[model samples]
Target: MALMKLATTWERFILKDLTKFGRYAKVELTPPSPGELGQVVKGAGGFVKDALTFKWAQATVKEATVNTIVIAEIACWFFIGECIGKGSLVGYQV
Candidate 1:
């Protein structure tokens, strides 16, 4: 009975969270329209310009540390996904 109650509580929490994110996902997952594509290109250009300046250099040590950790997390997740896809950690089995 305790186990069932725990599972029910867990399910409610998950469903609530999923409902919140589903709204965001619906909007974010849609393909960008042509006008949005131009905006994206402009944004990319601005990002490149910022990267070339002292903007990044001005980041505090804490901000730089957080950014490095986030990037490392992304890289680790990509490698994990590749291993999952290949069905082996070391390499694809023949």
Candidate 2:
């Protein structure tokens, strides 16, 4: 049982080390308050709506941005599906 516990701890520590993106770590920004974090999260939720229906916002939208929306929607849907049932993923070390 002691050996099993050591192995498990080693594996978790190695994974946490491996997944880090060191560039972002160097930035010196204060952590968001809980309320600010919630608002930021809520703002991010608009990404899907903007991607799906943003062309409607303009009288004359560019063709490239319109095309990007279709691609974004497909990619976001795949990410959503992947997130539904999975446990841990590349989201570690956050």
Candidate 3:
């Protein structure tokens, strides 16, 4: 009985460790492809340009709406970068 208990404990420990590693492996990341990298660089510039174009000196409701959209677009770009970098685009619906 004691040997059985020891075996079970060791198994639990090993399985727990393996599960943690498996979780980490769920998102295997590869280096971005050349095209993806280029897009990321270009997207960063577009983000900066959009922010600069906002007329901070004359704040208005319309500009605020546009700013929100710009934020969403930048967020999308970042998501794109991550997906492409991780090579996780397989069967992913964007």
Which scores better on lDDT, 1 or 3?
1
Among these predicted structures, which one has the highest lDDT? Answer: 1
Cα misplacement distance, residue 14 of candidate 3 (Å): 3.5
| TM-scores of all predicted structures | 0.58, 0.28, 0.39
Model 3 CA deviation exceeding 4 Å by range: 1-4, 16-20, 55-94
Q: Which stretches of model 2 miss by more than 4 angstroms?
A: 1-29, 56-94
Tens-digit per-residue lDDT, 1-94, candidate 3: 9999998998899888998888887656557789989999999998788679964546688987898899999999998998897778655555
List model 1 lDDT by residue over 1-94, tens digit each. 9999999998899888999899999999999999999999999999899898968899999999999999999999999999999999898889
CA lDDT, candidate 3, residue 68: 88
> Each model's RMSD to truth, in Å?
7.7, 10.0, 13.7
Top TM-score prediction, candidate number = 1
RMSD of 3: 13.7
What is the Cα root-mean-square deviation between model 1 and the actual structure? 7.7
For each candidate, the alpha-carbon lDDT, in order, equals 0.94, 0.73, 0.84
